[model samples]
Target: MSETAPAASPSAVPLIRCRGLERAYGTASARTVALAGVDLDVVKGERIAMVGPSGSGKSTLLHLIGAMDAPDKGGVVVAGRDLARFDDAAAARFRREEIGFVFQFFNLVPTLSSLDNVALPARLAGKGASEAQAAAQKLLDRVGLGNRAADFPDALSGGQQQRVAVARALVNEPQIVLADEPTGALDRRTGEEILALLGEVVRERGATLLMATHSDAAVSIATRLLSVEDGRITEDRALTPITAPIKEHA
Candidate 1:
């Protein structure tokens, strides 16, 4: 028998691609297929909105794409790296370095000040305390929360806390921002403001944004609108170009 050379691993090209993604929970007899054969291609700097009714799999798709959860079958590729290739440790590092998340609940620690909360991610990534503080300060200022930096989560209003969460999401300067119902916690007025801020940040940083939302107003800023229903994508539409934020009406 002749000896053969080893095959090379897959190339690490930078883009988000999902192949026949399917996810289900619970036993086979009582399984819930949250996602079914979902295929997605998200390139750098693309603004995408995943819109669906409640329980329509929007959040599940976001979590899978963000590497927060894995599909029962199929693979998730981000920045040309297959997520399935990583071990638990590597996956955590990848998420820390490349994925930024904003949740609807604005999960800031109640005891921490806004500045400290925003700076926590960087700190966890081994940044020096002072460096994290400076970066957090700048981010909070960008989000118009500079004056509230010393305030704790309970002291700030819903919108302010969400703004702090936005700052925290950007603290690490991740390549992709995955947001799940980021505007859901706020009233219409405040939600519009946060959406506008998100639009501005996405444009300014040239970062890819994939948001899961049901609100029509949330989809207004998206460059592409994707509708998922019955565990499949039913529509993908490119809307009018979005350059400026739609003003919020009180």
Candidate 2:
């Protein structure tokens, strides 16, 4: 009988781990590979940025880590659960309960007020409406959107809406926050403000953040900077002075 390799030691296990991860679409003649043999480890409370240009698999990697998508090969383990181990239904629940997401487009519902939008996740998690709304209010206030809580998405500027999105992401108190090009749609000044808010909140909560962006300013907020090109990471550097100003925004 053959024996499997022993599991990695506890001290070596990462909060997020991707090993030989790959994602491909279509078959032989039309196969498009988004990722190829990627390996990475994100420790608890670590803030890392994945920087890459269009079609470089940065978003795909983020999705895979967030349990929104599965890998075609290899594995992605998040919060100690491997992506390959979960069925679709389980993965969806895991996403709702364990991962917080902030997208560039700010996916808030048009009909809901900013407060309601942030509270939706808590409601989904089974909190009473009043309790959830109160929690939502606290988060919104922390993000500097307390006065805009009753405003709808259409009434807010891009940055304000994104701040609401950030607040919404924290509603569930997820262990890992995944942001994909969160500042892509905002003006430089507004984007900086949103990024600063995100950094502050993540630090205060001591949650791990893995954000993917093409902006140098975005990379500057990260404690560790990783560069991806041609669907592969070419460099990974830990910035000594992460607080240094990179791009002057606002």
Candidate 3:
């Protein structure tokens, strides 16, 4: 593993910081390095896209930042707290309250209605059922799915389900949102819509967003782009302003 990267400058605290992060899987003979001394810093409200081929560690980095998993070496700091130092309980609390995650598959409970699916996190955090459902409804409205709130995930279209997933991620009003190929399972048009909704919602909330995806449409929506290759960040650059697609008259 490489030496730890220096801490972020004190002038402006980064919302997410990774220092010499490393993770490996399997036995010595079959070891696979998922991350190799990676370093990164993301400011609040920035939309960062991690693009890479399969097995390039984009998801691994996001997982580490989201505190879903611990690194084998080095550390991750989010919202000024070191994730490496968090005890199991602390880690669980941090994930539940401070961070939001959207996965490639809509991980909604099949038995739950869209409103319940979005409200589940808040319920888990101790909010009253009515209050949580109210918040979830507003988020669904924001995602253009207000009419589908009472429907179960099985009854919704893939796009609608993914929109519900986005709503669920925002229910807690977290400081950061992490998405792993959030639009991967959808068609190109649907994926574009999801990306636009994600960008709009995260920007409106003033929350940081870190997404791992291979879609160029997804990359275009990001303010910054990072390319991961062979477990290392090979390119990091600010993207030019992204204009909304032009609409043709009917």
Candidate 4:
């Protein structure tokens, strides 16, 4: 697979920024730290893959960046707006307009057709049904799922459902896409396909991508790799063209 170019110089304004971020769960007796003083900066158009063992703060960091969850300390700033400053309504608006998310479980509405599931985000943002459906159709085609648009989630294979999820993530033309273990549920071959599609579409749309995964094949496509452990980033480095070989599932 071809590698994406590096992002702009360090002087350029970062699209995502996290500063002294800290997150924890439970009470004092049973407290568990998810993130501890984690900081990061991502420029526009960067494909960043975060890899780590289970419960290593990868999901926590992604949540903070996506504003799905707030940090107990510090702040996350995306496109110049401090996430910590958003009120409930503003946060909702920001999520709808500025950020897109993909999850391990396809998370499609079981009752909605693939096209409708893709179009739902735009529709909820007050877009006309016709306009949203049109956009969703175009995305479905881009993901090679145009013919499956009318099928419900239960009717499609796992790979097909994931493709729909990807289309849904891009329907709103978000500036940032946060994926939490997006390929975790698939077999290796399907996972590679999903990762490749994500890299291609995200690059084509000029959207920054931050993906959390355990698969090295997934990391191979990233422009930068970050490894987190014990609630902190242990490695942050750029990947060369020959980062890692893509392996097939047995």
- State the C-alpha lDDT per candidate: 0.85, 0.85, 0.88, 0.90
Q: Which ranges in model 4 have alpha carbons more than 4 Å from their true place? A: 1-8, 241-250
Relative to the unseen true structure, what is the C-alpha lDDT of residue 91 in candidate 4, on a scale of 0 to 100? 90
Better of 1 and 2 by TM-score: 1
Q: For residues 1-250, what per-residue lDDT tens digits would candidate 3 score against the true structure?
A: 3355332234777888899999999999999999988998888878989999999999889889988898999899888899988888988899999988999988999999999999999999999999999999999998889999889999999989999999999999999999999989999888888888888888888898999997888766788889999899999877863656322121
Which whole-number lDDT from 0 to 100 does residue 159 have in model 3?
Answer: 88
Structure candidate 3, residue pairs in collision: none
- TM-score of predicted structure 3: 0.93
The full ranking of all candidates by TM-score, starting with the best, is 4, 3, 1, 2
RMSD of each: 7.3, 5.2, 4.1, 4.3
Give candidate 4's root-mean-square deviation (CA, Å).
Answer: 4.3
lDDT of 4 by residue, 49-147 (tens): 999999999999998888789999999999999998899899999999998899999999999999999999999999999999999999999998999
For model 3, what is the alpha-carbon lDDT of residue 243?
Answer: 57
lDDT of model 3, residue 190: 86
Q: Per-residue alpha-carbon lDDT of model 2 for 189-229, expressed as tens digits?
A: 88887887787788778888999987767665777888888
Worst 10 residues of 4 by lDDT: 241-250
